[model samples]
Target: MSGRIPHVIRRVGAVVGRLSVYVLIWAGLALLMATAVIRFYWGEITVGQMLLNLVSVETDGGGGPIVWIGVLAIGVLPLLLTVGIAALWQHVRRRERRRRGHDVRPRRSQWVKRTVATALVGAVVVGGTTAFATTVGIGDYIAAGNSKYDLGDYYVEPSVTGAEHRRNLVLIYLESGEATLADDQLFEKDAFAPLKEVTEAADGWQSVADLQQTQGGGWTMAGLTSTQCGVPLKGVGSAAGNGALHELGGEDSYLGGVTCLGDVLDEHGYRSVFLGGANASFAAKDVFLGSHGYSEVKDLSDWRAAGEPEQSFRDDWGLSDGRLMAHAKDEVDELHAEAERTGQPFNLTVLTLDTHEPVHVYDYCTVDTQNVVTSVFFCSMTQVAGFVDHMQEKGYLDDTAVVIVGDHLKHMSAGDAFHEQLDHHDNRTVFNRIWVPGEDGNSTLRPRVDQLNMYPTILEAAGMTLQDRAAGLGVSAFAPDVPAGSAQAMAPEAYADLLGSRSARFYAEAWAGGDAAR
Candidate 1:
């Protein structure tokens, strides 16, 4: 009886060990498979990028049932494959033992040990490949002192000549809006016809044919920061520390070292206000804007405080773009009145949210379209155009420059149903239209322009000339020295390397120290 008990204990231990190994193998393989899925969906899958954007994913309320279904598929496929392979291997061994007339029970412990070894080896292989790929992908960016461009050479300082008359600026950032929306051939119907009409009919409005996205330029905060500051927004430390700028200790002064467009406007005695249809705290937008001299920052919370009903007009993000624009019209009137009283130029920057992911269409502002995304675009464009027309009707257009720009290219999944109705949809460009006060209705279509150039371009549109027609690594598209498709524009890859360099870290640390002092 004692000998039988010892044998039973050993058998139980072997089974437990084998099951642990199987679980580990499946987990490792599933993680690798998930990495591949993420990479396919979003071009990059770095830990830093994931951590920095995790908050936005949680707060934005963008993903729908389709996203969760995809996630489930990614998780289950690897598990099913692992289980199927293991079962087949076990069945073959069992059949061979039965044919040989050998008691498979006698060798059960040995077979369990072998299976555990094989599972461990499989896990190691999968994990090793994933690690190697991640290291190779981001190695150049993380290498110390490897910056190819000097920050000083690309810094843009607006030299406002006394002869140049400053104009009021109204910059509107459309979330995930793209030029493809206006391309009739790309969609079943034109998604941005209203916006296209506004651009085509208005003077000094040019549609940039090519607007390449740089590293950190694909996301909203990154896109906005790059366009405003002429630099990519990079994470400061480990994954755990990449939340809002306010949470980053001394690093709270967003782009403290860089001279942003808002800073220049502040220097010229312009009162700037940033109004967004999302929480400003989500991406530290308030911190960035306040640090950079935006006089007032208004967001969803402000809307609620101002007696706007939250239930009917607000979605997961905030108030609909329809409501935002409506509120903006009133705010613009008040700001303009104050400007008239004080004789100070005011910069009103409005960020629309209707076109954000999950593509929520407000019932009150619905367009006649089956596709939710298309409807969102139609409604947003109509509202924007109406706002512009209102400004024009009120004589605001005579001394004001209105610039409508897509913050980043659209980030729709490849598996989206909307992709079925497109032609040559590989290289999508962001939408950009600049309407200055006095120029003739001539379109200056540039072949390719990076987001960084927008920093100088916005200033130029506001009637401010750059000291050397360049700011940071971005040469203005309108600069005389920057000819069409010039090499003066830094490549996106090169800019990414700069962001990862030790010199960039040094600059960031210095900025943090300055913020701490203040």
Candidate 2:
């Protein structure tokens, strides 16, 4: 029976020894496969990327399945090694006893053998740890983990120049108003020449769009979202699913929204006005604006009341930019005059349709409809030039800050000019033009602005105190400069959260305010 027991133990020992070897090889191969996957996806994955990926700071307290798997693997390695080695040693001892019979006395050198075994195990462990650390840049990698940026620390300050009283803001968004388009010719310089002359001839302000997240193809909604949310558009699909629309609508209470901006304006005693191009019905313009505290809205149908037939039926999609501009000028004048009479300020938001699609104005244009749409863009520029010039003549320029920005990039059907101007993705470059009555000489600010920062920049210029939460992806042009790569501080998920949350809050508050008034 004793001999049989010894034989059984020996067999178990051999099996365990062989299993250990197989397990070790399996572990090594698994690690290699994982490394290969990382390399392929990242294009340049080093061991450091792997280690960094492991040290996630789980703020949500749910370590998740992946974390649990890692923890279990870490816990099992030592235990498996210890049990395998012990089984092997016991099997070898038993085999020797069975061979010599009568349990032959062990040698005094057993202590020495034990010491050597311990030393060897220690060496393997230390060597493995050192190798892992060195391959992954563990030290520097660990240091980088210390500087995590939270999405809650940003803010925007509202302070308009010379207007001690908080005033309602009117932001007019024109589509595809490239700097070149404002020029007399369809070529690049000609397109932008008028804007250049207007900005250059201004008293103290400088003009620069400082387009951000625009090295890629330009999309119109993407630009509008960036300006409205004070963050880049993220992605078109992302915008569709996320709170870019919801936040502007104020569906969530905490995330800031266009309503939040309106609320801020409301607190300063201003009403929000949203005027869409004649095609306000085409896009969900009325629904969106009405929810965002723009109680008064006038679109294409409204132009019909003024007996403007050409303006009323300009486009199947929307009104002509020329007519929209004309209406806006009249409305703004009325509002400004009313504010003057009542000791209050006004806020207005406008979306222009002149540059809508079908790149209409061709040198040898055959399509009449297309020509009107395209001509309206040029006319819109001329109109904007005249509008600013008119405001200057009326002396109201000193009291207002006029900002001309493109709502979205136009989707050209088939244009070589567009292909030449943008990348393969056809991203419309967001063109921003700002004229603050008196600060026209601030050249230091031209190169330092971004679309995401426009909200805070305007707010700061308008004299409102911005809370840290409002800082968002935008920085005040009046604020200090952040280093180039600092914008990428948050991971993609965190950034999406940052944009989504704020948008949700803005929309929720705006909707709530409108609801309360009703």
RMSD of model 2 against the true structure: 16.7
RMSD of each: 6.2, 16.7
Tens digits of per-residue lDDT, candidate 2, 1-518, equal 88899899999997997567545543543343333333322222223224223322221111133234444454455456556666887798788778778455666666787588657655555555554454434554344334343222432333333336344455767666554344234333344444455756346654454444331114443454455545433221223244334433323331233323454566577767776654443223444445434568786557666677652443344455556666778888888888789977777777765455433342322232233543445555665666667666766667776666765444432322444434344333456666665564655553534466666656655455565323445655555455343343445565444443323222333223322111
Clashes (N, CA, C under 3 Å) per candidate: 1, 56
Clashing pairs in 1: 154-472
Candidate 1 weakest lDDT stretch, 10 residues:
509-518
Instruction: After superposing candidate 1 on the true structure, give the runs of residues whose Cα lies further than 4 Å from its correct spot.
Output: 1-48, 54-109, 112-121, 124-153, 156-164, 238-251, 310-315, 365-367, 414-417, 420-426, 443-446, 483-503, 510-518
User: Per-prediction TM-score, please?
Assistant: 0.76, 0.55
- Global lDDT of each candidate: 0.68, 0.49
What lDDT score goes with residue 53 in model 1?
Answer: 49
